[model samples]
Structure formats: structure tokens, C-alpha cells
Target: MVRASTPSTWLQGLDIPSQLFGTTGGSDYELYEEDDEFVLTIDMPGFETDEIALAWDDGMLNVAADHTDENRGRKKTYHRRFRFPKTVDDEGIAAEYTNGVLEVRLPTADSTAQGTEIPLEG
Candidate 1:
């Protein structure tokens, strides 16, 4: 017998339940700050290196994947959304995928410009 999901259970899984009724499509992510960069980690169970996409536009970072696992007959969809802090640097971003996890490194602006000095008395 197939069991149906309740409203509460469904809402709990969604990225933005209040706005979008069901669980956020696709995967879940974690963001953290290190010494000189902002890091984003996402869980992508069955994705390949080529299936993932990462981009930065209008000061926003977008990560997505089109993954399919035929053996398990699983087709996952995602619509998760997140907002970054103003301190995050949009340039000098890098991403990598390994062991079903995607890691993104965004260098902080201050960190990127650490060695440049201006001559005020020229």
C-alpha cells in the first residue's frame, strides 16, 4: 500500500514552505564563512561532474543540476533558493563536486585585494 504525505511533513521539506507549498525541489545546501572565503556545500546524491551548473549573476549565485538515476528510477526536481550576504564577493568563484557533494568557494573581496596598495603621495 502507498501512503500519502501530510501537510506538515510536506512543508517541513520545502525550502520556502510558506510561499511554495511543497518541499524545495532537488537538494539541500549549507553556507559558511572561513578565513578568507564564503563556502557553500550541497548534497547531490546521484549527479555527475558534467550535470552540474554554477553561475553568478546580479550578485546572486545559482547552482543547479539535471540528474537522473535509471537504476533506481528516481527523478528529482529542485527549486531551492537562498540569499547571500552583502559581504560575499561575486567574482573569483570556484566550484567542485566530489563524493556526491558539491562545494563552492567564493573569495571575499577583502581577501582578494589583500596585497594591493595605493600611493597617496605621488
Candidate 2:
């Protein structure tokens, strides 16, 4: 089982602009293994394709999004990171975002755990 970090509650409990815009609430994500691949699903309520960015570095997957309301001067940003396992094929990973959800597919590397049977000498 894999779990992503959640937004700090202490940050949301405070009443400051910097806190509100900084470490406040964030989008939710779910991860699971499917066949020979791992799937990640994130919920993004009000974000455009252009506002989101994805990156992979140091065996970690990073996602960041920023949004601002022009008329209200309100801004919100969401960021999340996921660490890939050694069995994952990071090079072939793919992602797509639509209908307020982001989906990432990470294919697993070729099976390397082989088994061999040995006959007992009588």
C-alpha cells in the first residue's frame, strides 16, 4: 500500500494570508497497483491544463498547480510528490488530466524474480 502526504492541519488552522496561500489545503490523490502497472488519481476541482506542471526527479514524481482569480485577487496552489518504487518503469510513465481528475500510469519493469526448483539427492 502506498500513501501520499496530506496537507498539514496546523497550516489550515491559522488565519494568515501567507498561511492560507502557502501550506493550506491541497488536492487529494489515490494510488494503487493494476496488473503490471501503478495508477495514481488526483482530484483537482478548479484547475486548467495550463496551470498544472509535472516533473520527475530523484525517483520522485512531483505535481504542482497554481490558480488565481483575477477579480477576487484570490490565489491557490496545490503541490504533491510521489516516490516511485524500484520495480517501476519510470521512463514509460504517462499522465492525463480531465474532469477535475489527474491520472498517472506507471508501468512496472519486466519481471525479474525468477524461481528455480532443485531435486533432492536420495
Per-prediction count of colliding residue pairs? 5, 0
- TM per candidate comes to 0.60, 0.69
Per-residue accuracy of model 1 over 16-80 as CA lDDT, tens digit each: 54545443332266777788887878888777888877777765787777877789888765434
How large is the C-alpha RMSD of every model relative to the true structure?
A: 10.2, 6.8
lDDT (Cα) of model 1: 0.68
Q: Report clash pairs, candidate 2.
A: none
Candidate 2's TM-score: 0.69
lDDT (C-alpha, whole model) for all candidates: 0.68, 0.81
